[model samples]
Target: MSHHAKDLLTLAKAVIDTEIAALAALPSRLDDDFLHACETILACQGRVIVTGMGKSGHIGNKIAATLASTGTPAFFLHPGEASHGDLGMIVNGDVIIALSNSGTSEEILAILPVIRRLNVRIIAMTGNPQSSLAQAADFHINTGVDKEACPLGLAPTSSTTATLVMGDALAVALLEARGFTANDFARSHPGGRLGKRLLVHVRDIMHTGTEIPQVPPDASLQQAILEMTRKKLGMTAITTPNGTLLGIFTDGDLRRSFEKGQSLHEQPISALMTVSFRSINAHNLAVEALNLMQEYAITVLPVIQDGSVIGIIHMHDLLRAGIA
Candidate 1:
């Protein structure tokens, strides 16, 4: 390789090594102050206001989003904007988490007195424990790193990563402390895939009424085949006159019957149907349906309600709805 290429590779490895070493040192820094910071946020009745400037501000935005989605209510505020009018967003019961690698950001320090006057709790995430911002806060979490990943040592590299990880640690600590569950996380993220998996029920996407492919138990196997073919669901439900489900006949059963040389046109569907089958409730989650399908190696399920066949759900339905 050329000298230029070798030099670039060397610099890249050095940067990666520096950042990895910084992360490796972080576990030892998690002390009583970290626990106290978590408790302060948990006890907070109002929102968490995360403020920073420049690169710190960008990381602060993501940290705020993570906290909000994980059950700790939070939003990012620009320290420069807070000095003008955004300070109104801070209230008595709220908690302020300020990010500054140097622990002496001028904009952040400018607003510290105003935050104190509002009687809100302050948690400072900084690289320097003795800096003005850390000394002024109610609690401080030191995110000090041994060195920057930047070759020039001027850019914010390892420091920003450490700050982001510290923010995640705080958010998750509070999440566990508050007993946050997947259901709660889904509620806050209703538009995402996890939300769909947790929130969408079998009834929400099941085919019901005229759309369900079903036949009476005494119907001919040919008639059950016709029903399944017409509905294009690959399976048919056998029910009584009162809409009570009895059994199910699937394409797999047809292949098995043909293997036995059974006459499809003359045999009763009741004789061909599989009485021992798995079914799901209408109220169960769509993910549960997917799980049931995977466990039994089946593609479709009859949705039951109060001992009656209410609807049918196909694997394709869950796939189309983005649940599978």
Candidate 2:
């Protein structure tokens, strides 16, 4: 590459290295204060109100969102806006988490008296523990970094990144403390792919009634093939007269029969079907069906209910629904 390109790459690497170093140094500083912050948020009966100014506000917004999504009820309040009648959002039981790298943001400091008057607890995250904001808080979390990634040290680079990481750490700690499960996460994110994977059941996507490819055990191989072709499932379920599943005849069975020089038109399907097959309950999640398919190397499974075949699920069904 050219000399100018090499110089640009060097500068980018320096910025990344500086941020990496800042993050690496953070764990040693996560002392009793970190635990106290987590406990305070966990014990909060009301919402967590996060506030900051400028770039700190941007990081605070993300922190609030992360906390909200991970079992803690939190929302961001612009410090400037909070002073202008928005301070009413705070209540006696609420917890305020204020972010300010310098620990003396005028907007944040402006609302301190009102917050104190309302009897709300404060958790200050700042680079300077001795700053007025930290000293005023019930708890202080030091997000101090040695230097900024910006060359002129005028931009909030390493400080913002460190603050964001600290927020994530806090959210995750609270999530684990609450015994939060994937099901809980799905409830909060019902519109996303995670919801589909965690909440969608076999019955939700499985084919039932007329859509199920089935043939009586006494039916001819030609009849089974016709049923499979008509249903377009690449296989046919062999059932007894009372609709109890007996076995399954699939395309693999047909290929083996052809190799054995068997008569496809005359033989009973029961004689060629595999009696031992994997099946899943209709109430199980769609992700379970995918796991069963991968574990047994099978593409389709019959959905069972009360010892009878209720529905059938295919790998394609899971894939089409974005569950796979």
Give the count of colliding residue pairs in each prediction. Answer: 0, 0
Per-prediction TM-score: 0.94, 0.95
Model 2 has a clash total of 0
> What TM-score does prediction 2 earn?
0.95
Model 1 ranges off by over 4 Å = 1-6
Question: Best candidate per lDDT, number?
Answer: 1
Candidate 1 vs. true structure, TM-score = 0.94
Q: Rate the local accuracy (lDDT) of all candidates.
A: 0.93, 0.92
> What is the RMSD, in Å, between candidate 2 and the native fold over all Cα?
1.6
Per-residue lDDT for 90-195 in model 1, tens only? 9999999999999989999999989899999999999999999999998989999989999788899999999999899888888899999999999998988999
lDDT of 2 by residue, 157-264 (tens): 999999999989989999999999889988888878999899999989999999999989889988999999999888999988788999998888899999999876
* Model 2 regions lying over 4 Å from their true place: none
